[model samples]
Target: MRTKSEARKDAIMSVALEVFREVGFDAASMSQIAARVGGSKATLYNYFSSKEELLLEAMLHSAEQHAENVLQLLQTEGDFSQQLHSFVASLLTLVNAPETVEILRVAISVGGTTDVGRRFYESGTQHVWTEISSKLQEEIKKGSLRDVDADRMAMHLRCLCEAEMIRNLLGAHQRMSASEAREKADCIIDIFLHAYGSTR
Candidate 1:
């Protein structure tokens, strides 16, 4: 049920992401994105004010698409350990993908001088944290998890899950395989549950 304008914007962002990946962000131009999107530069400008804004929007769009499944996994009926494993595994798979790694590199490269980092955090990562925190709060209320600051707990869980994976993304190690991601997730979840489960 998207309006024409919304649909067009989505198309523009999708094309922009491709262009950004095909050419590094610093080399990408609005003109290139507009060309690929089948629109004039003026039309592209109507949707995005600048290349930075478009990059941020495109990154957010990609994150949202990847998060849809993770969010559902978090909310699914299951043991907390199993659910956490599923969520983290799915998240690692998405974040470790080459396209996502490329976008993240662009975000990091421009983070200091541009608002792209802030916008990316607020629009993408923050939303994921908020959703996970809410789910944690529900689990605490049900006595499956210990009573703790849900937001802080959620952040801690994310940090643990991303510890080595982030290094991998930064090229410290090879990208993790699905089995490796699940194994890592299981270990993190076990540690998390031991510390935060109701009995603890």
Candidate 2:
């Protein structure tokens, strides 16, 4: 039961994402987004204080939608290995997605100039890692993973899963195929398990 205000805000954010993607952060203007949304600049302002704020919210909105699916792959439906592999595969798909890579680039470009980058890191990336850490902690409690620091392990897992992300973002290589993504996920899980898999 979303309120009209909430729905309107989401519509604005969706249009804002398109504007950001087309012209990027610096070149994008509130007027441009407002026009695209068929609303006045004042309307957009009512929902978001500034273009930076709107950009952050838009990227977060997109990320949240994608993150929900990825998070679901980490469910406790199977063994820890199955969970990790599925999670990593889905994560690879998400990160390598064109929309996501563009958002990362936009965030990085504005990182020094504004707080949106850091805020996105805190609210988006860190939040996802926290969710991952919780899953790793559960595995540890079940003796499926070693009794190491779950948070640290989750960080390591994230690092490994995203090892090639920079290259993908930079266009150094092509987007991986589904088979390739799954293979990479398997390799990442293998490495993680080698280190953390309980010897018991």
Candidate 3:
């Protein structure tokens, strides 16, 4: 079902991710990845234009499944507050994942001097936040939420969801269990609703 080219590319991305995690973006080199993949540097170049591109692609591939699950959770129908709680819980799980946290560190570290940070945000983070903003806008129209900026409200919710993310990135996070995540989500939703719940 899978072509050899596809398989080879997957292998390359897998090795690249491992190398990036091991040494970070600055210390990682194309040659090191090529060696790990048992391929020539030229072959590696054919797959990815640069080390930064490879890092982004590899990290994205690694986190794709979890991100999709989180997004899918967002689409499930529920009471607005319940939906927000579920979304927050799912998001916390995703962000606290080891691979996801590593990618975030990579983004923050390289973002100051390179396009990788901007591109990574635009590619994934922006899309997720936009979905949240859209949900907020719908609730605002229904007068369930206060009539404030949907984007800003979404930003607030995201901030709440990731309140512990820095600890994860620093390898200091204690990953939450399902009950713990749900409880944390409840706290976040309560704060958000307290601030934005309509007075009706």
Candidate 4:
């Protein structure tokens, strides 16, 4: 039921995300995004009023997709441990992608100064935390996970995992390899199992 314009917007936004990640906000130009998207700068401007707007839109788009995906995973799956595992894997897949690192790096550079920066944190990063927190709450209620406060658990998970992950993600080889990510995720996952895995 989506319109062609909507599809085109998605395409433009996707390209913009890559460009923003690559060159960053201050370095990335509208013309560069237009060239990447096969459009003129004028045309790109018509769709988005400014660089900040486009970046914010792309950040929101990524967040919305992630939230929807995690929620869907929670709804369709019956196993709490499996859902947590799947969520961790999928979330890492998103975060470890080269482009995603670019986005986060660029955001960290601009996050203190722009509306888009603020929106990205509020809507994208924090939103994921909120969704994960909700999922944890549900699992606790179902007695599939240990009974713990969901928000604190969520924050702990984010702080313990993602905070360290940024250093790994931005390391010299360009990004974390699959094996490396597995090792990193496994360590925290054990903590999750200890605290939340089903106990008889």
> Against the true structure, whose TM-score is highest?
2
Question: Model 3 clash tally?
Answer: 0
The lDDT ranking, best first, is 2, 1, 3, 4
- TM-scores for every predicted model: 0.91, 0.96, 0.86, 0.84
* Arranged by TM-score, best first: 2, 1, 3, 4
Kindly report which residue stretches of model 2 are placed more than 4 angstroms away from their true locations once superposed. Answer: none
What are the lDDT scores of the predictions, listed in order?
0.84, 0.87, 0.83, 0.76
Mind giving the per-residue lDDT tens digits that candidate 2 earns over 14-52? 988887777789999999999998989999999898999
Off by over 4 Å in 3: 1-4, 62-64
Residue pairs in clash, model 1: none
The per-residue C-alpha lDDT of model 3 at residue 22 equals 72
**Which residue pairs come into collision in candidate 3?**
none
Instruction: Give the clash count for each candidate.
Output: 0, 0, 0, 0
Better of 1 and 3 by TM-score: 1
User: What are the per-residue Cα lDDT tens digits for candidate 3 across 1-200?
Assistant: 99999999999999987888778889989999999999899999998999888977876676565567776766777787777778788877777767777767877889898888887778767877887798789999999999999999988888898888877887897767888888888899889999999999
Determine which window of 10 residues in candidate 3 has minimal summed lDDT: 59-68
